[model samples]
Target: MKKKIGLYFGTFNPIHVGHLIIANHMVEFSDLEEVWFVVTPHNPFKKKSTLLDDYHRYDMVYEATKEYPKLKPSNIEFKLPQPNYTINTLVHLEEKYPNKYDFALIMGRDNLKSLHKWKNYEVILENYSIYVYPRITEVENIAVLKNHPKIVEVDAPIMEISSTFIRKQIKAGKNIKPLLPLTVWEYLDKMNFYR
Candidate 1:
């Protein structure tokens, strides 16, 4: 049987406890054998200036996931073309890994609502499974896809914490250390980022 890997893609400006909690929950509660945190290099919609250097963000993810054997940090998108799309990443991963791994998506309830806007959403829905975690979304327009066979809603904890909030707190000279893993916190403190 192919090893099941859940891809949790994010910028991970500074990977925090909230991200770990969700990834850990997915691997523990779902069929996923491992949860790979795919660090996004450049998101088209987000401003490049606000983001930390790509390697810096990747380092934080590596530090944060060090303790968990089943959790890993992947810099796959870093080698890919700029302004990457999820469908392209998915296809690349499939081709690279071939039958060695069965890849799946780990996303939030909010992302599921916007999945329709993604490039080749139908292809993704048809080819791979998506594990959705709870989020405090205002609307429920995803009623159609909610019950789809390809999408499984995992009862993971709702993590309201965001990297943006952490950055803002750090810039304000607040102690946001507890939000991140010990190693990640130390890395951020040593680098003195966001301040």
Candidate 2:
């Protein structure tokens, strides 16, 4: 059987508790063998200035997920082109991992609202299965994409936390102990990040 991997791609600027929670639930409830946090060097839609360095972000993820054997920090996009497109990353991962891995793009319902705007969005719909988690919105209308037979709506615990919120707190010199994992918090303190 092919190893089912959930590609949880994001900036993961600090890899907070909310991310870990969702990843844990993804594994517990789904057939995914592992959930890889594909850290994107840059997001085309977002401002790059606000982002922490890619290596810093990746290191934080490594620290945050160290305890979870099923969670991995993938640097595949680090070597790829800037303003990385999800479709391209998926295609590359499919070829690179070959028959050993099958991927599901894990995302929040909030992202689904603008999924049509993504590069090669239709190709993504036709090729890979999308697993969406609930966001702040209670009513998610996946029915709009009901035509896509591969979409999967997953009911996972939704946290009200976000990396932006955590970063803001950190910049304001507030304690973010509760926002991230203990190890991550320690590492951030030792490294003097987000100061």
Model 2: per-residue Cα lDDT over 16-104, one tens digit each: 99999999998989887899999999999999998888998898899888889999999999988877899989888988978888888
Best by lDDT: 1
What candidate 2 gets wrong by more than 4 Å, as runs, is 139-143
C-alpha lDDT of candidate 2 relative to the true structure: 0.88
Best by TM-score: 1
Looking at model 2, report the run of 10 residues with the lowest lDDT sum. Answer: 138-147
RMSD (CA, Å), candidate 1 to true, equals 1.0
Candidate 2 accuracy as TM-score: 0.95
| Superposed Cα deviation of residue 66, candidate 2 (Å) | 1.6
